[model samples]
Target: MRLRVALLTVLLCAATVNAQTWTEDGDAAALLPGQTTVGSGPLTAINGTLTSGTDADLYAIYIDDPQNFSARTCGGTSIDSCLYLFDENGFGVSMSEDGCGAQSWLTSQFVAAPGLYYLTMTAWDFDPLNAGGLEIWNDAPWGVERAPDGPGAPGPLAGWGGSAGGSGGYVIALTGATYAEYGPPPPTGACCFEDGQCQVRTATGCNSLGGNYLGDDTTCTPNPCPPPLAGACCFSTGGCLELTQPMCNANGGAYQGANVPCWPSPCVEQPPGGGWSDNFDSYPQGTVLYNVGGWTGWDDNPDAAGVVDGSNYRSAPHSIAVKGAGDAIHPFTGIQGGKWVIKAWQYIPSNLSATTYFIVNSYYQHGGPYFWTVELHFNPALGVVFDSLRDPNATSALPIVYDEWVEIRVEVDFDAGWLGTVWQYYGGQLLYTGNWIQGAVGQLAIGNIDLFAPHPETVFYDDLSLQPWEPPTPPGAARPLFAGVLYGGLPTRTTDLSGFPNTNWLSGFPFEVDGAAARPDGAVFISNGGFSGKLYLAPVEGPAIWLCNLQYPAEGLAYGRGRLFGFCNFASPLGIYEINPSNGSMTLAMSTGDRRFFALDYNPVDGLLYGYTEYGSPTGLYAINIDTMQMTFIAPPIPTANSAARAMACGYNKVYLVPVYGNEGYDMYVYDLAQGVGGVWVPMTHPFPESQSTGGAAFAPGHVPGDTNCDGAVTFDDIDPFVLALGGQAAFNAELPDCYWRNADCNLDGSVTFDDIDPFVALLGQ
Candidate 1:
């Protein structure tokens, strides 16, 4: 066993940045099995020569300590080669034949049971036949440190050991510790994890090597590559995102679990609902409904006509004070057709300087000079005034209670009953039901007809809405608000009223018909994305025609009284897009700061665009002013992880919402648009989760006038609710809400007032 050992410099062939300074050549036959020890040292480089595939160089080494053993072949000489390790008995231990782009390596565990190991090098194919050497190391974990040369960073120690007469930076010996605990330097292209990357490596190195190296002296332990850990995270805006848990929570999103997919969690489509709503709580008392709707003179009071006074309000925060002079006469947006129920919460001062009246200009009827008003006279002399719209010539003489909040309602028909019959309700009690008006209805104005300068009273009004009046309790979860259908089938703008009628007509596309918006022409456009994400011009009561493909899945879609708007996260810039329903085309409208919003709708009440999306810290309900693209946070974010999730609908003067629990259906929340963008979102009276899908909303068709029975007709059987109403029983008032007491006030007089006795008797005779 001749100990062939030497310490010297490596013969530089083409090692671009050569570091090996020593080497030794010993052919397999030259150092036959029994003749060993060609190289001996903890750190050494053996230079070997090969003439053919069978030619191999063998090195024998003795380990003093058990540590990880690593041997790598470095070169660019085009000699395909492999490194094999064997035990003292010549039994193979492990072998690695890796790719060599100037570097090839193999790492293995060293066991003490076989104290002696043999290292052999062979070529896969011989070409240039340049001599190569073996570099060995103790595999110290000292943080798995890499020698800045990373793959080509000058081999860790000199090619040979001190015993071979090597100088400083030479190898030393250590005892028994098999390598697994302290692995050698990793080859290039190896990965580092999120917190396990090197912290130091010159900017020049990182830039040149295509790795993140902040400075010098960086190693794999501290400046390692980031681990690829990604999944779904829910944001504060009810937006489910594909991000790491940390990124999700940091941006206000709740992590549902690990490995969650982004699409099924939702990344597109708009939910239904969005019109107008106001609780009069989100704005200053004088903040007129102008921003909410096209109205004027809300704060104008030069003549002291009116004021949005917070004091003496029936509804907290705000109510317009009518100091005579058509106070707060708001011209509501949109000319609603079909059946409309216009209702308002009002408060009249116990007494008045003269007489004030809340009127709906339903167009004059019965040959009257002005459109009729459901007049409720507070005058003790005039008595309990009711049903004035039915018989304007009548009067009452009975003392009636005043000075409290009261709701007054009226139904107007623009289709069959245009300027025809009108139904009035006082506190939900049907007061007048007949063809009462004669002209086309426009807007509403409430004030005193007798503008007496010495008047000593003011009228307070709040929560006014002209919504389609369907029965309070709809048959299903969602009652149809418009005549449009969901998108299905091919691209045709015609109605295909067939198949399953449960609102799932667009099952193939929307699968849910999730997002919806109404055109000014009363045409309904639905998408299968929220319900699908495809925008379409749908037929009323039938299937919808695909209009255009949304660039990205839209999380929210809304059609303003003037324009259509949609929220899309993948639409290039990730923002809102204005869709052309005529043809399926989209135009970029606004960016959402990369935030994912789930729903969008236009509220006719505040004339503002509102929607819900990822707040990145909380699920946020937001109102965006189109003119300034300014976003106003409406309320605190709703949590949506491991819960129902959140969905919203907008219309009338309210925003209907379903939070969390949406997966299994949850209670619906209604936010007043009058509350501006900060009012509390309260649950609606009913918990109908049926509307939790695409077309869910709060607008429904109103009862027809003259249908006192509200049975959709005026047959002889229509007298039941009226008869029950006269006696003040729950049966007759079933069609009304609490707070109403004028169901049978047929003669336009106060309840229990003597003036109604004669009229009642005459009506019974008929």
Candidate 2:
């Protein structure tokens, strides 16, 4: 038994032996660049075991051009390795040690005009009895050597030629170009323009983009020195014409910045906008179908057949073409849960069948158990099939022109509909929308899927990308402020709604409210931020009660005509909900696409809800139907630098904008609420100190009784208009408007806003 145990130990030890074990006296043979290579550099480490403190090994290589070079004992080994580089003449030209510190790597890339070079690897492993090996690269690709979260005490160093502090399997790459054209972006202020269609950009860089002669180090600050805003945006089909942001945003082409014409830039992600873009233009004329795994085929194999067609294309010098039915998939990151728009330009030379499919969010991997796959197929009879969710006999024809290049798109929203949804678009118009029936989970895979396998048709594709379809980041100073109507309490220090001479009518203490609204019964309702999911109701006569769970803590809440309305501005698409007054339950009223409403209030006069939408170029006010929830773009008249107002309260005829104090970094803008004047947010005086933070607002107008003006008699004369003007939102002209408030200042107060609502009702009762 003991002899068997000894033999077993010997077998285990012998198993670890192989090409991995480097011998000191082994052949000083040459090694190929990538044969033993790891991710970054050529492999030089022959899994060697250390003999003693004096043990070492050497390897040789011949180089024709001067290039960046480095060597290290990598692979998270505890080899306090020392490395040396010698010229052909045997002179030790350079040397490195645990220069990477705890990373225990020795690296140097300044090797030049190489003829013959020898690298010696040695380490100071305390456990010398254990097998030791030298793992290294000759020309290491630039990468973060050490990160705050990793071994070598460090920071981020990207690209090539940077040293790393972490121990890991590293490979080497060689570059002889004295100048680096693409590195980190040229300083933030420096303007950069790429893609035949670019946003307006100023011309200033180290050198012109398409030049090989280095030495162009000019800086272009597109802002301060604005780029030529006017320019022809070029499309992949090689179409070009001048257009601006608004035009570029809509036109199916690339919007290259100012001064840059379509002659050289690449066109990509036409019409649709995304954080990242590709036009296949970067591929040399003979490139092929490949994954990000560097030119691998659509099937993810480097040798997979495909072509970068320069002869027939859109946008630039190249587009991808598959001889037969082939697929290509792209991935995305940093996008939130909402709609992801997948777009691509495809040229199908021959006719095809409804069997020709395009897929979105398809994750049927390893061959079976299908996840959700939104497929678009061309069936001459059925038109475009919305894949899995197609209704029986429902033929929705997607018009596709053959032998021509056409753009196709699909919008996948994982956050809405009964089981998520897919909306297909053709020629900038929504073609069809289909809901997912099965597949509850999967990944975002956008590309081709052949439902009718082995179709002899070839499909050329280009400008494919997934863009985020969500709200613009809220305006710089826009914040949800709290405001509510008070029918039965004393104004407290915290719930002060006084814009000027404060009032005694107050809300039962505010609870750090971020949003507030009032029911028709005069009970004030409030919610803390959008994700809190909790709301409160302050009765007219008693304490505030923890109302039912809102489920969606909407940033904007309103009460009108016996119902509760709310706008939830969280991660997913902005959703509108109707809250039940009794139990605080919620029903998804609708989705406003990406339009984010900052605050809203129901207009008692028209029974319409008016509020601010901060999703477009400039923030604007919008009117929403109380019943249908259909929103009409009233006007984007507010010119605040970046959508500024966070909360607004409706008065008689005007809306009051409130600031969250410290949140805004710029001057507050005030808009004219009077009718006829288009909305323009002009800079206004900030009434509160910068430190004060207010969440929302409710207009409380008081009144003076018996005077003709607030004289108790409501009339259409200038006196009545002037008196009611104090009520706000009141449209007072020669013609009597419903908004004109009667300064029934029943309590003999000066103003006539909501504060007089109860008092006016009392007078009416008399």
Candidate 3:
């Protein structure tokens, strides 16, 4: 059989006394998690001084019951009772006990210096081994009373009607609680009791059994409780209340009466109203109070008393006020101008010279276009001066005036220097220009002026304008001329071999053989046939051969008016080829070569082509009609052993020759085509003896008429040489051609004379 342990109910009582007493309630039954209810009540005393105490104590007065339980198991699974005490000094204490079934009494004490305190009790299973019930009561000097009184008390002993069938129940009561001086404790294990109070144990372990129990009584007194001082309020065991003026609490301690006295607190006092003045009455940064509502203003008003419209002004106590004079009397003898714009409307006067002139002028000391004034002025009649301190001095005069309502236009041309203009105007009309009564008018003043006409002047002004002048323009830009190189010596060769007789010409299978003639039209022509060649015109100084192809020549060659006549030799037929000078393109002019043609030349005089045959008793020079392909013997060729003239050149109204061979050595001869006669073959007067052999020659195109040497200039050097050569007094020598007799052939007509001097001069440098 399982042993059964019955629940036990114990009724233990504590005997410790405290100076103050408080009661509390434990937690309500069936409360949810995180929910709590607090018990509250007023503390009433019985035969004890509740007014004063340095400490407080708490007690738990409650009932407990434990139902049937097994012999080995105690009914300790319900909530336990706990008590806590808190003081106004931020101190707290706590005590706990199992229900009346276990340790029935719980108490906590704390030091609380003559002030309000609070106590609390809670019921919970704080320890896993304890589960019981609780009921709380106020343990004051009065007997223990149930919370909420009588049957309504919250506990198992309150209005109970049940059978005790092996279930435990106990009723705990608190009594004999009072405040008094603590007495010496009885010996340990001593029991004591009082009316309606059960036996309780003292702090010394002495139990109170059936006697007047003084264990709950402790020392409590009024203890000099006073009121709070200034800047503090009275907060008592009741609640907090504010301290006001006159009702001062000078004792600076706690008080128990209503409306505890206090003084007007500095903590709640309003800040003082402040103002400042520049006069020595108040230095800068110094302040004073007016005790009035907020208002602050700076006054600089003068005696004239001008009103500033649309401005609201007020003065604040302790705020700074800077004062200056507004208008002043002028010392000089000129018209007085008033202050245009009033900076401030109120002012205080300094103790200084009152009669001193406070003249107003339109010049501001501060650098700006706004208007200001001065105390001195200049007069066109009596010069400038200032007023005396006490009396109007003889030097006192009216100040100069300016138009304030208009744009004061001042024009300054830096280029014009002093000649620039300075003008003032009222509206659009000009008021003053070049008429300034000049003097130093020092201080700006705006106020009343006691003059011959005593009256105050008020003026308004703004927006003065200035115009800056510019300088003149400087000169312009410049340009240059276009120029190019006209003519010069070019290298050429007519041979087929390389590196022989100079590499002026390139060698190939098919070779073009022709003489290039430069035309006055700024072009050149080349022939491309063996003997029956094609003529191609090319641009002057352009590439002689472009891409190894003749630009002009699917056609044949030609020579006629300002052109070369092309004809075939014994190997090929002749066709007239007109060459385009710009790109070397060739066109067929005419073709006729059954009559064998050998050489060609152009008559410089008539601009006609001369052709020659290879075989004849005397090779004849014939003029060809380029239009008709007809020919006439213009001149007989040279008497030569060979049959044909190999080369010919025409210039100077004559034709020159080169023979295949002659005993006279590369002989040169000229024939006058006009005379149609054979002349003596004249050797050219060459400048270099090494170059005397007659290779080939042609007259330069566009030759200046008197520049014989082709140097483009005529001079005495050409004249003297022709005079000597015309006299025939010297021999024709190639080494000294300039002095040779052949040089007289200046016209190159196979003779020399003064008539040749002209053409000699024409070809002098050439």
Off by over 4 Å in 3: 1-513, 521-524, 528-564, 570-575, 581-594, 616-618, 660-664, 677-697, 705-766
**Top TM-score hit:** 2
Candidate 3 per-residue lDDT, tens place, 1-766, comes to 1111011111112322332232111111111111111112211221111111111123221111112100101132222332333332213322333334432232222221222333332332221110132222222212211122222222222111111212122122222222111223322221332112233334332221223323443211322112323222321101112322223132122233333322111121121111111211122222221111111111212342222212112232222222132332211111112112211112212222222222333222111111222222222234322322211363333333332112222221212221122233222343333322122211111112211112222232111111122221110000000001111111121221123222211110111334434343222344544323344333221212221233333321223344444443332234545555423455555554544444455554565666555544344666666767666655555555543343455554565544434333433355666675444444432211122222222332331333333222356645543444455643323322212233345454434456776566555454
**Can you write out model 2's per-residue Cα lDDT over 1-766, one digit (the tens) per residue?**
2343344345434443222222222222222111111111122344433344444444444333344445555443565554544555433445554456632333344465545555444443311110121222222222323212222112111111222222322222222211111122232223333322222221221122321212234333222233336554543222234445445544433467664432222332322334445678877787554544223333344444456778778887788766444454442212323466767787755466435555543432212223335656655444443344453344555565677778887777755632457777766666667664333233222223322223566567777766667742211111112243222111111122234223212112223455667542233566654465677654221123455677667677776655677778772556778877546677777777767776776665556777777685445787778568687766664444444455566644455565544235543334445553365554443323232354545432222232223222343433445445444533432233322233444454434455755555554455
Q: What is the C-alpha RMSD of each candidate to the true structure, in Å?
A: 30.8, 24.5, 55.9
Tell me how candidate 2 scores on lDDT: 0.45
> Which of 1 and 3 is ahead in lDDT?
1
Return whichever of 1 and 2 wins on lDDT.
2
Tell me how far the alpha carbon of residue 585 in candidate 1 is from the true structure, in angstroms, after superposition. Answer: 2.2
Which candidate has the top score in lDDT? 2
Candidates 1 and 3 compared by TM-score, better number: 1
lDDT of each: 0.44, 0.45, 0.29
Q: Which TM-score value belongs to model 1?
A: 0.27
* Alpha-carbon shift of residue 331 in model 3 (angstroms): 95
Q: Over the full model, what C-alpha lDDT does candidate 1 score relative to the true structure? A: 0.44
The runs of at least 3 residues in candidate 2 whose Cα sits more than 4 Å from the true structure, single-residue gaps closed, are 1-510, 520-522, 539-543, 571-573, 637-642, 661-673, 682-688, 691-694, 700-766
The superposed Cα distance between candidate 3 and the true structure at residue 193, in angstroms, equals 99
